[model samples]
Target: MGRGVSGATVVMSRNKFIIYIGILGLLIAAGYGVWSTLEVGGELVLSGVVEADDIHVGSKIGGRVLKVAAKEGQGVKAGDILVLLEPYELNASLAESRASLKQAEAKLAELVAGYRKEEIDQAKADWLAGKVQHENAERFRRRMGDLIERELISHQDYDDAKAKAEEAEQRMKSAKERHDLLLAGTRHEEVSQARASVEMARARVEILKTQLDETVIRAPVDAVVEVLDLEPGDLVGAGKPVATLLRTNDLWVRAYLPEKRLGYVQPGLKVKIRVDSFPQKNFSGTVRRVNRQAEFTPRNVQTTEERVLQVFQTEVVIEDPDRLLRPGMNADVFIPKTSS
Candidate 1:
């Protein structure tokens, strides 16, 4: 009876040892399978976040902010008004410049036309009268000189008549010169200078207009407003950042993969992306670019090793982007082999 009990206990111990060995063997096989899968394909994986193109909008001139046309998170199109600076000063400057331009134009026209016809006619008549007076003076001087020779007139009187003839001749000459100058148009140099002045004034007006236009800030591209730093009555200076915008359409994910997997990761290669924010959702994308240089693992990434040892940065362009995959949202990328 004791021998039977000893045989039963031996059988139970042998069976328990066999079961434990089987379980251990199964665990080892499974671990080996997982390691082999990782080694054969170099399944490099990385975590990244979606990011859009960041842009800063600023003013070109300094002035007090008159209006803020955008708010944070507002979608805006190209050329949309984003801000308005106080335009009173610019408008006044423009108006003054335009007035100066008009005045310059009027003066230029007057110079080109020269003296009026009536003024020229009056000058000519004066010249003719002076000529006639000089002729009479000469006759009187000749008559007086003969009288003086015959003692019929005094030498002083003859000398005085001769002086009158000379003075009349000089007056006629001065009158004729004035008439000719009136008939002739403006000098070439004078006309050129006048035209240049007009052009300069016109250019000044245009410059003022440009400055006024700049007071009304507009978006350079389609984007979403990310920041609004100034509102009505706020003062700003040239190149002062008034807002920030993000180009949603230009969004992409930046990821890194192990150097060993570089052969499979090429531009234009298809990829599958899954964002932690939307685990159930899967996104299709293509490799837009792969950095040729290797970099250290980002500080945000954690692995069994303190560093990734070696990795390359890559950009994946989403085929279809939605509002849910916003900038800074963490994502996972799976780059399947060509055969897979």
Candidate 2:
């Protein structure tokens, strides 16, 4: 009877242990199910890097660098001078152009003003001199005519006097024409030509002015200098990059989303961006754009659904990117799903 009771008690203990184990397993399974459901229905997060556009600033004209006002990673505002090129040659050219323009403008003014007082006086004096000579020649020609009629002078003498009078008359006429031209000032065609010359000179000066301004390279946008390729006394070529500036104000997170999740993503959607550099802070962003076409799957997408052969690129522009975010820094973008 004692053996029987001991065996029964042992069997009963084994049954209770099995029941407790089964109940615990069921509870554990139910908890796993709830966790998986939450994971599936939670907000989607994407991994990407902070990126921005880079601008290469340089001079339009090539010359030796005179000064580098900015260093690598220096912040600069738009229109700030980042580099200065030697302006000796360009300045000389500009001065020459300005002188030429001044001369042209003066000529135009002179043409518009007509003749000067001294020039008109000289022209009038020549005309009066020609008139006096013509009058004297006419008197001599009349005397020769009278002598020829009385046979006191030869026909050859009369002809000589006539030729002299005709020559004097022609001289007077030419002098009168010159005086009229002087009084009339410059001709229309001459004035037009002068104006054209002035315009051409003005255009040349403007071009030189632009070139001279280009000698001082300024930042095109608010950015941080990412590269400084030249120092003082270094030669730089035209259109060659002297410095590269990253546009910090236009910062965005470039992330890839699974092709299947593209249907829910739209422009102007709010998102939260996080970076390993600043674990405690979260940056707010907006969905600026989504790629219309699918591309090859990116490595960042790890979900089974995202493991498909295609993914879509998306850009989330940060609202206010301070020093917290940097280009090429790995970032995570979390986008909450909308209720169906």
Task: Highest lDDT: give the candidate number.
Answer: 2
lDDT of 1 at 111: 87
Q: How do the residues 249-273 of candidate 2 rate in per-residue lDDT, one tens digit apiece?
A: 9899887766667766799888888
- Whole-structure CA lDDT of model 2: 0.84
Local distance difference test, candidate 1: 0.80
Compute each candidate's TM-score over C-alphas.
0.72, 0.79
Clashing pairs in 2: none
As a TM-score, model 1 comes out at: 0.72
Global lDDT of each model?
0.80, 0.84
